[model samples]
Target: RDLNEYLFEPSKLVAKVTDIYLNFAEYDQFCSAVSNDGMSYNEQLFPQAIEVLERIRHPRERIDAFLKLGEHIKTIADQHKEDDVIYNDAPEEYIDQISSILMNDPVMLPSSRTILDRSTVIRLLLDNQIDPYTRDPLHMQ
Candidate 1:
């Protein structure tokens, strides 16, 4: 039976794949090997995945979900770093609290008081040059 022919709704399939990919980052490597092209189903589903990620509009929920996904990637990345031993860097506190000097409001970044991931903020800044929340200048301090 062809997996592609399976009677599954695309949304359900995407959700299941998203969960699996989020839980196990290595799923891509293994899956890519099995596919005709050097890409996994997730890679094929990239457009849909972006849609799903973008549809999550709430900043807190979006950041939280991304962080949850990041945990899986971070675990795998940590193992590879250990194997390579490129840098014996100590783990620092994950989040940081800071008053947004621009907005003058308390906000958390990554590991602390605010939920926004620094990378996400940076990406948003790069893409739009404006803060998603306050619509102010997105400056990286």
Candidate 2:
């Protein structure tokens, strides 16, 4: 049935959603995903990823997304490193990579973190610490 097909083909839908979110930076994907009736496999993951993706455009949003994600990742990380700052350690060089993303758009930056100079984000992206292109919102979520 067509409905079954929609529910089962979550991967394809996710790809489509990601393309729209990344290229156009639109939130309609959330609405469409919600239209899937909440029974689809990717239903939850798709919208959740969008929430994470939206943060990239603004600093404050980014912080909120990461903090939420960090909490989620913390469960697994706690098993290894219980301390909060364990993952916070970014080498000075790595810090420089994300700068462009930060300075270019202040609102896109998060409010929680100290927000190392824009240079830091730039370095992270340039040095390979952060893969800006390949990165998906789902990753942080």
Q: Provide the overall lDDT of each model, using Cα atoms, as 2-decimal numbers.
A: 0.46, 0.41
- Among these predictions, the greatest TM-score belongs to 1
Give the alpha carbon lDDT tens digit for every residue of 7-42 in model 2.
Answer: 775444544555544443334444333332335533
Candidate of highest lDDT: 1
How displaced is residue 22 in candidate 2, in Å? 1.0
Q: Once superposed on the true structure, which residue ranges of model 2 sit more than 4 Å away at CA?
A: 1-8, 26-141
Write down the worst ten-residue block by lDDT for model 2: 100-109
Angstrom error of the Cα, residue 95, model 1: value is 44
Output the TM-score of candidate 2.
Answer: 0.17
- Candidate 1 lDDT, 25-85, residue by residue in tens: 4565633223322243233344456466556432445435545454544455455546436
